[model samples]
Target: MGSDFYQQSILPFAGIIIKICRAYTHSQEDFEDYYQEVCLQIWRSRDNFNAESKWSTWIYKVALNVCLTHLKQRKKGEQQFVSDALPDEVHDDAKAFGSDELNLLYNAIKHLSEIDRAVILLYLEEKSYAEIGEIIGANTNSIGVRITRIKERLNKFIQAQE
Candidate 1:
């Protein structure tokens, strides 16, 4: 019984939740707190899931909603993390991402307003425009336009870094 649910449910979505939390929250403690909160939310909400969409889609909605609400409370200004002192695991992820691209991504993301980052994060994870809109309470057509500009702006931001 113990291994059954883990094998069926938790294992599949854990990495996605972790990555979403990481992308949304810069502070380590907050990230862990929110990640756990998301897990609890998932467990509680699982029964309500109707499966009209894929399981991944439902999980994304719940997890992203949790992150957005949490991120909305953060301060306005962006906080920069100096690469040198980052812990080995995070440091390795950054390094493996390649300095140039990773720096561009971090700079681009850090520059986004909290909500915009949430939009872009879900979009990047390949959520459909309708799903993105539903998650953020926008129309699908509008979200499609916003995503295009967001990608362009992200590119410009990367260029600014270079």
Candidate 2:
């Protein structure tokens, strides 16, 4: 992809990566490392971008892989991050949605199996079922059914908070 396309199409998803970081990291520092790693992974994979899947779908996979790699290395006693940094676009809306109600949502998302969480997040983001299936490497016919169950489970978790 051209630099202009990356600046436009890929850059807009920075917030999504930040949101994913917020869900996965416990501190500002770790989040920064995870976010940067995700971007780097996406950059490395750009040459291989296949039009078969939506850009967002491909990004979600790369972001998750970056987090999982960092988390694994962290478990091995690596110093995964050295700083807490915030990009200019990260703002109050992300922090606002991260409130108690959405913290519950984030926590609920965490409870899902890795691939399940990927599927559900894309679903919530309103990606087509076909796109989600392509992203998760699952059957399109089954994604809708899995998403329905995911919503039901999330509803249960949210209600139990009451």
Candidate 3:
């Protein structure tokens, strides 16, 4: 049952998990840990899904919540020491979405408040304001306003990098 549910449900939405984890983590090790936690969480919460929203929406919420919690825990000093050097193997996420501009954008995103990071990541994925609101627990109206502001802040950060 677990294998079947995983193949059918979790595997299909893995990209969403990957993207969210990438946005919330700085290093490859942290990304892998967050990805595993998110998958475990989605599996554990499978029975709790009431289907009020799409499965993808539920997955996003789980992934974001896990990452946010992980971030907070790290701030409290659960974080491990990592070197400043890049990993030998290019990150799969980086290879898949690699570009200087995207790197700059991601660096800018890291500066956002947690909620703003989630909002902009979903916006980049082209999720509708309604869907984003459903995932992030914001109203659709606020999602629109937040996205506008996030974009403005992102533009300034990116320009400053030039």
For candidate 3, the C-alpha RMSD (Å) to the true structure equals 4.2
* Model 2 RMSD vs true structure: 2.9
Q: Which candidate has the top score in TM-score? A: 3
Give the poorly placed runs of model 1, Cα more than 4 Å off.
Answer: 1-3, 73-100
Error of 2 at 114 (Å): 1.6
How does model 1 score by TM-score? 0.73
Q: Residue 47, candidate 2: how far off, in angstroms?
A: 1.3
Give the TM-scores of the predictions, in the order they appear. 0.73, 0.80, 0.87
For candidate 1, list the clashing residue pairs, or say none.
none
Question: How many residue pairs in model 3 have overlapping backbones?
Answer: 0
Clashes of each: 0, 0, 0
Give candidate 3's TM-score: 0.87
The segments of candidate 3 whose C-alpha lies over 4 angstroms from its true place after superposition are 79-94
Cα-lDDT of candidate 3: 0.84
lDDT of 1 by residue, 13-107 (tens): 76567667777776666666666667667877888989887787777778878877766645555322222233233434434534666646855
Ranking by lDDT: 3, 2, 1
User: In model 2, which runs have C-alpha deviations exceeding 4 angstroms?
Assistant: 1-6, 75-84
Model 2 steric clash pairs: none
Local distance difference test scores for all models: 0.69, 0.75, 0.84
